[model samples]
Target: MERVIGGSDRSAVGGRVPACPGPQAPGQGAVARSVTVRLDRRSLRGWHIRLLDQLGQRPDRRVRIAWVTQGSGLPGNAEVLFRLEAAIHGLPRPGLATAAEPVALAPYEARPDETVQTGDDIILDVSGAPAAPAAAPVWRLDFDGVPGEAGLLAALFARRAPVAALRGPDGAPVAVGRLGAESHTVMLAAFEDYLARTITLIAAALDGAGSPTLPDGAEAPLQPGRTFDLDGFGAGRRAAGGLARQVARRLYALCFQGPQWRVGWRQVVGPDLIDLRRHPEGGWNDLPDDGRRFYADPFAIARDGAVTLFVEEFDYRRGKGVISAVGFEAGGPRGRPEPVLELETHLSYPFVFEADGQAWMIPESHASGTIDLYRATAFPRGWVHEAVLVDGVVASDATLLQHNGRWWLFATVRTGGGSYSDTLHLWHAPHFRGPWTPHRRNPVLIDVGSARAAGPVVARGGALIRPVQDCRGGYGAALGLARILRLDEEGYAQRVETRLGPGAAWPGSRLHMLSAAGGLEFIDGSRPARPRLLR
Candidate 1:
């Protein structure tokens, strides 16, 4: 009734694998082939069943999966297997294949209190039992090839799903963690970051320790063949509409929605409040920028009764950003903005802070695969690279704050392969620059609506307030203010209090970054940019 088959082997009669009866509605076509799924007893949980269920929903290709247990009987084996069979039945035409390589389902052991080195591949021995109690809850990682770091990374990237399918023994869904960054070469670092954060999220979910959040638009049920749409650009609709719609949509995206951003600012009277409705001219003051370049992530610092505003000036021609600063007085700007820091690669989010009576900055240098700190040698004009706080990773918006006798660093880092706007990570140290320790819950937040750091964290009324970008609609679509409830070496937590969007006060389509200093608040928004045609 059941047989193992190699991946490349095919049926002899029609050059196509035989169809099998599936669990879909009557009159649906049979499945193309059957594949054997080897479930490791150690990691046999609900997620495996969920994954199989998802795979069955694809209309183009249907696979019949044969369940083969690899390890000894466990407590939840019967229930998990039953769910898996039910899931298979829910698809269109499910049957066994005559010849195909068995898909291996295995466990990836992660500890809540320890770091997991993702280097070696492990096998499941038939005689082994489930994991111990002290270990974190096991979640099945489904793969076709030999288990290793590369294989795991490949599977994740191929899936392209923001959240992994994981569940506890109780059949309840577990919160999955991710490593979010903005670079291309540090996927392994992202994997390590994911492992660490997943363990923390599992522990917190079990003990009811902290409030964990999932990325916005991440609530959709995982479909077997469906891919996560990063920009919600109606790709699925276009794909369903036919080839012509797809082509039209692609062309529309290419012509209209090219890269562009604009900066806006208003004066504030207090630390805890920002009223966009009360601008000098009943509207936001737009920073003057040439059509070729735009400004964003505006940060202001006051020194000796003078205010200096720094922003990320991105030139569309060069396709990179440089740090620029402009002086401001009581009425308006003292002069035009001038470039202060230029690098070979892209830079943004000029997070500036004063420590030890000196000015320092940590602009987003994720393109270089590191978070580098810079020291200002001469006020707002000269800057030199000072230290590398974290390396071998793509970290963005390196916002720094000093509180409770310790210094903290916050950023939205890309850990593996996903959107760069979702994973918020934290680090801490005793001094502004030195050896830093990653939080046990490294990815403190994963919500696309509020994960990316928008501006500096400010202390007000015995509480810390953090500005976050709400990218649920799109990148830098809105701004959110969160109050930190708990933050320590063991864990982290926050609650978003207010969300500000682009509208009456600021006439634009997006509002992302926010910073306040010397009773002035700086914000940025996006507007339609005129397209430039080449001669």
Candidate 2:
């Protein structure tokens, strides 16, 4: 089953998500404080309502919303674009309402906030220039180098500019991000996704742990500080073509499932993709699977003179995934994968490794809002719940690494209401089992193309090599190898060195995972598959 953004419509009834723990200052904890949000009265959107409710729900703050009438509203064509895209895309109209009418604000007593006026032409003063280093009393949103939503349409639909939150007075960017969409064909869905992430960015900024630099762009650099004019970019013509393609895609899905994933394995004599930086010759051998289920996220281990491979077995009938394993002998899989672990919630990315002289697995259990540890009592099958490493988080592909006498957990988290991949979060602990502390800079990176972990982190030549999923094209559409340049308590960083995708060597449209153990390498990708009856 497809997984969309979680908790998107929570604002409908003022639902509350768990508040992100803000980083404590050098000597001060997050004490309760009064916060007033300044907004443009004319361009109120559903995200604004959600943002206010989110801030108000924080226990560390008393929140109130104030509307100012001095800012420009959304462009004249924004509503027209939304209505047309909604009709063409068949999106959830009620839940994906981008435009919202002004609602009653909570009664709040006025406070004395020092204000500075800019002549009589009030341009919604929050922060002024891109180079200002000081902060103002209020906050404002900027799109395509302008205040308010004057350039929102051209930015999102045309230029694809980075969104920024500027503090008043100096307008310095606390959080700046280059947003992305799951699919560009559906304009409505893309628009909603951008707004969801935008809210997450602002919330982080308010918490004082905001990132000062732009998220790392592995394939390309992001110019979040650049300014451009608010001009048209032929959005009308592009919309017409997108509508036609979207309709065709829907019609095709009616006859068959969208795509099915499968695992591929091959024996290697020397260095694998980690060192070669290219696909091995003679292609790969398929790990056969039954027509009812597909396998992905292959993780392997070599122990006691035996090599075992684990994968995420997703059955079409059940609509959920479970962990399974297959042994390799004589340079080939022994048989089809057998169910090794199952749970009430969906599971994938079975990150299996040896710790404390025993086998342990940390599968993706973000569906249950926790990252858990399981110990194997009977080798690969008898798994017991050991402990909860991290809680109250929707983290995917939880990969663990032990470096410099400290255990670090890496995963891409779904911040508030956004895509499953994009925002990368880090947590560190003394051991793999006990209490885990979130990094001071929670979201260390936010690039959709290279944020999500695809497989294990391997050590080679005193440097950590990470396998990441390139989701810029789509979820798991390609794979990349990044060199972890610096990873410590102070901060974390990586530079993507190589990217690989499906082509002549791999006859598919998607190539996602990569892992190696005992001279055996494994990878997975997508291909077309049909039901038994249809086949």
Candidate 3:
């Protein structure tokens, strides 16, 4: 629900990225051509107008708008539910001032004198459709594999499907994304995030040189089985529960942190999680934490004799996180985690490792708008700032791996206005510290279920395995292991081979972040816990 894409306004992270121009063919007369976008005047919302504004601002491509005045609008209860939830939660109310006003479309609508015509080279239909006829190749914006406003309504009201995508006229997928609602209790926030992602997907598809394909055996297209009722039955039923749900949530927040994450670890033998593809027979041992705080994003390193574990220690009273470390011997943890690195800005995912005979850390500093390197000047404590690997972008959980004589930096970027856990961006450099170059296709992948970095990329068998956070259920709801098949200057690719979630072994509602070192494996998951006062 953050202000993502508006008229040339900057995002929380940085400046607005211009829309991608429609791809041009390779020929003597090669140049990006105009595309016709058909929209429903009746259902026109702020997002539709935003999308059109983006397309019109395409640097090299022109846009023609076609109005569908006869198109059906969303369920009446849709806006009602959004307003109800916003009022109770005190959520960000973007465009609420003119929520009831009709959008003026005359400025954007194609005039009769325009050179481009509908049903020409390509028709990008966003309206509830009898899609444009076969005369032109059509790229239809869909939600849960159903086109237009109805598709979004079906997912929000009927199926409540977490996954969404864009499909071509032939039903082949152009881009697929998981809805990123850290909690699904609020429907409007999730839909707004989805709309932001819609903009990113459409832009990428338009500008990408070659056809984009989902990873082999990845998320299959979701079918919203029965068409959603436009009569508002589902939306009406959901709205009726709003008051009760809001009251219950308020009571819950009074006593406990919405989600208190914890770390779990256990000694391993020959094969680790990357090898076994399942949890070990003996369940994990809890890494203890005081009731006043929670620990998460575990990473480990083997030193001369013992293993040191690093984590993000978040204090309830302070409401900020800092890097903490603990040492482990044969029996258990040396003691409680001690603060190792505290900064003015929030930090997490203490990505620690050894190189050049010195310990180093790259704690996620996305909130500061920089990815920094810190050298342990005095072993575990006395850390000193070393270098800034990348800046000017909000990058999360930056995991680094040296492969094929290159250092590959992987992290999910908060591009435009979508979930910070969905779009995967890559940067590489000859050394770990300097001169990083972004991949030609910067956002190599956009998958909410398996895009964010969970932990380090390690080698297994003859292949490289990367740990990714599966955020479809929500951010850090699950963990996944992906096989890095191709990664180089030209392109990047990966296949999610396995996904693990909380169960009897983990005993939590969320499981995310995986790491292993010195015959010890580490993981983290969410557990509900009341505040110290309540306890």
Candidate 4:
């Protein structure tokens, strides 16, 4: 037997049942029960209609849903309805021998506004009411309809060290449900991407399918003692302003304050690996380039007693980067850096390696939506396109390493318009250049601080050390040295050992890239530049 309960008015479902139905008899066909929810037709909105449509798609017949319509004037009434629909969809199905248990409809209590105290400083205002407890010491989230906010709160609440609660506008406790966050410009392309990702997140959260956190590790809130106020940063203010003001701000940024990156190098003396902490403060050499063009992502290789350095030469006027290299000896560059490879699209992170007695380079060509491979025909300069390792993806900073007779490629990828610096994806191949396959756990890591590949992977004393960029402060804010604990087809994991920031040791505003070869280490940092204005 199947039943549909609708609101306090039992008249909708032909009044209340004489008694709750029990287990079904044997040899009966599968009984599928679906409840068609009907909100007040006069108050039906787009979201309400969408909720009903989603609920109508359930195939299970043995499940039950508690339908309640109480306190229609509550601030989060619509949100509650949405959450109820999600909860109903999440319920387990009843077995063939027994009927599903009855779902009890709970009444929503509406009260006056009050302040709720929490350990974390985030203030959530539902319907402009501030009713929350004052003595709790756990991370508190204002149960408002915001994308990414639910996952953030859920992660904090999962810690369980402190008490957490979700309250409604009337200051009544409520159950946490699906939440998502998305933002975009007025452009149709941008809005489409944002909508697609927002839908994916909402479905995943409600279904309990994937990780319960944002890709950029939004779950990990700002560390204690370090305060970051979104209001103080003016981000909220700008978002609330008129579209003209936003356009003006963007134009100003484009005309001035463009990114300018420069590469720096230091000579190491012995066979032992360089202890990055003890690196000297001075004697750092800067790569030479014209003001219109900047160089970064320094990768060096020594072959037949000759050392050559490869870098990404970015031309600001053209807004693209091409691979360039220069000969380096003991003191400094043997000659001016020359362009070794050019592509129509932007490229960086010239990851060069030797395999099967052939030189190969995998430059960051995410702009082309492909990870490509290039083979050197004439050693240092002459290069030819070998193959497309991975296609139809936006990936950056691909670094390859050989371990246990298999090759692994690590790179940060953008998924459904998410942040490019957070989700790390891996692929493995029997050889360096052909027949590559994605790792079972494609995005093995999701952390803004250590997801992007910054430099080459090195083995030191049986431990694999990887250089990663920490972008919490901003993109390329600092560099982190992470040790890979486990890496295989099934999974991947790493732990950051130490972090290096730009200060007395390296006099710059940002330090991002790190690479070592032939007793020399190279890094890149950014410094503030005075933009030239044309009268």
Candidate 5:
């Protein structure tokens, strides 16, 4: 076979890299090691990658590899890996064993980041550290629901995972993309998914290649459930110092990864049979509540009215995710609940309550990517989607509560471009109608501990209580009981005195929560009664 050297030829070529005898792994606080480069085509770098895999994280997976390059603002800005004997100067003058050649002269698999364009050439002048080489200093501030939560905000949204350098399930490393501020919400979520999916990939890669096992990345303190000390991280600011900035930088460097991140899971309850007497259509269809093909978030209230449960009924099967209500008073109910508010598609987070002699509702309207409130025009049977309190939300499951003469709203944000099911964001308004202002500390609350919204119900004791989903164990497997100590401009602070019973609700390894309910009410929502065929 003619040795198809480097350049823009999309062909399969193979070679091997020599070995390195330096540091073996990149631990939480460890230094990176250099690998031996061999071969002739930019393929040598490819070879170097393969060599590193044999020296992988665990014996079973390929070693994760990342190239560090000084960033360029221009179009083709990235380090181009090439063959040892490839060209350096003007254009390529290919020789058997020449001085060097640019990877731009290489085949697809032999080149780095597969999308390199033709006009793009290698610039070898600069060198920098790979992502895993960065550091993450501890953050002590807890944005207890105030504004300008710089320290905590920076830390919470910091791209702090070493995902690109981690081996995938097949012993291959993740392809790293450009790194900088994740300015948009979509980028943030994409980043989070990247990190998480990379980990899974590494795990699968390792399994496939008969390599050693890696620790579950999602379960670590440095990952999905990352912890920050509340001392350095509160709603109020401490002294502004270079130290804070340094910590932020270190975190960005040390823990940042391709997938931006957050956290999930708690004690998930079932798709209990909601007496659909409200949806008098009768057998329009029957659905289960076991949480099979659907899940829901509901609030039960008894006003001058009857016991009504407002829920966001999600039909993963029908894909027609909608919002509806079901009512069942203690007297053993008469008829099945019916669907009241129906939409074409995309509606969730059906949080219902009565205020000022009127009923109000908020459901997850992710399609519009905004928050909307509805008014019950005709008791429990009819609702009109009236107002949009907030728009451009990259978050879900919003909660609005009237507190201390002012109205406070809580919602989980997918910060650092990670999972929508992770990270928490807060906001408030003087009135429920909301000329709503983002809590100065927008994501005033965080912690995979309760990053996502479980429920923000108030307690009978007068002090506020929030049921937090403890995703540490897994989604909805456990719950945390948090007491809202303060929610004023002074900054919101919370004391999670206890974690609600881990195995108290469902007999599984997960949990899910929606909205804040008042005094001793059974949370209700749409759930499937039987197991789902999750294809």
Candidate 6:
């Protein structure tokens, strides 16, 4: 780069930038010796340059780049000054390896509204070839933080090339709209840096008219008390994220692994809440009893005189899968218990219903990666693999309900997370048999409170009332009631409202609750009906 100091050549192409003018030259604000006003054109997303000379602070050690966003209000040109030493005990750090801001050259050649983050200075080499208008010089551009760069740019860096030479279908490096992720996030990082520097050089030549000079002693300290900061996973960034992460960890521990299961429950099995195991017409063995510890779903009442209760009993201490069922007299021996169905490996969320005189059950079939429907051959223990409703699918806690004359299935899908209790998707069909269509607004509902169906039941008022687990405070945090306000061709609309909780009754301190609740009528597997799975 050649330069003629203090001449008309100062603003010529291929010239050096005039050194940051010491002690002023009118309204212009440039103190760096070699800064150019022109650059190689590239991406124009949210780019801006910080005028350090205008901040009243001298560049001391290095520019600390903190990509901070304003919490509220249009803080244009309002530098969100952050204090470091006070934020942390001293110098803060981040989870990433490098802490210093990446070094960068300016970019004004392609755009004017370039808002730059302060101190973005780490200089990594990238393997990428820029794509632009036919005559635009083939170049590389740095992309600091665009979202999907992880997959695209990272792969490019893995190619082990400091520069990626991707051309167009015409094998032309310089063409309009020919840019794609060179491959990996890191590669993209390097590519962005390379181009940024090139663009800076170009703009410098244009601004200085080929006469540029580097500033002398431009390094000075910044704002008073501006120290280092760290964040949630380590480096202090924002206060909101750190607290949110802690809240998430605590929730996972209390829900599935909570001691509520360890403390054997003394659920009174007769008619009402406090009837215990004894009564005038029924003894401990008088009321129907299913020796199972937990009901996978509360018992479902058949229009006839039979009550079906699906129980989730697993030997977590022994192995992974263990589930069976128990049948009790609806109004007879009361406590006499018998086994119903013990699946081979694992089975849960048993959905039972007697439709058109035939009994059907669909348990949580997600373990097998398929949804299978079973038909009861006998009242107590006989069940056969009646139908393969949905295969190669992932549906759990599949509860069935007849709504708007169509059968709707609700389940929490295995959509890429451990918090299965959070999101719920819906599928509907005119017949309980085949052709299930996913809700157009599939994830029509999201609110940890009612994401998972408690158990499907036809409300006494003839409306579909679904019990839901409220996870606002925590998982299984509370029991909630949801009435399907509207279910039609238009779509499904439901509202969840808090109903009962641990404070609702004795032994109900955040009780494992509301799978299904109703009345049953039958003596074991026989007559005199009136039976329901209470809690």
CA displacement after TM-score superposition, residue 390 of candidate 6 (Å): 2.7
Candidate 2: pairs in clash: 126-168, 136-168, 136-169
Task: Work out candidate 4's RMSD over C-alphas.
Answer: 19.3
Model 5 Cα RMSD, 1 decimal = 22.8
460: Cα error in model 4, Å: 0.8
- Give the alpha carbon lDDT tens digit for every residue of 32-71 in model 5: 2221111222212121222233333432112122232321
lDDT (0 to 1) per candidate: 0.54, 0.66, 0.68, 0.54, 0.40, 0.38
Tens-place lDDT per residue, model 2, 443-527, is: 9999988899999999999889999999877667799999999899889899999999997788777899999888899999976
State every prediction's TM-score relative to the real structure.
Answer: 0.52, 0.56, 0.56, 0.53, 0.45, 0.43
RMSD (Å) per prediction: 18.6, 17.4, 16.7, 19.3, 22.8, 20.0
lDDT score, residue 218, model 3?
A: 62
Backbone clash count, each prediction separately: 17, 3, 0, 12, 110, 85
Between candidates 3 and 6, the TM-score winner: 3
Off by over 4 Å in 2: 1-258, 528-535
- Give me candidate 5's TM-score against the actual structure: 0.45
Clashes of 4: 12
Q: What is the lDDT of residue 349 in candidate 4?
A: 89
222-247: candidate 1 lDDT, tens digit per residue: 33454432111133222223423322
Residue 436 lDDT in model 1?
85
Candidate 6 shows a clash count of 85
How high is the lDDT of residue 43 in model 4? 23
Q: Which portions of model 3 miss their true places by more than 4 Å? A: 1-259, 528-535
What is candidate 3's lDDT per residue for 118-145, written digit by digit as tens?
A: 3355566676545434455666665554
Q: Write the per-residue lDDT of candidate 4 for residues 450-491, one digit (tens) a residue.
A: 999899888888899999999877667788989999999998
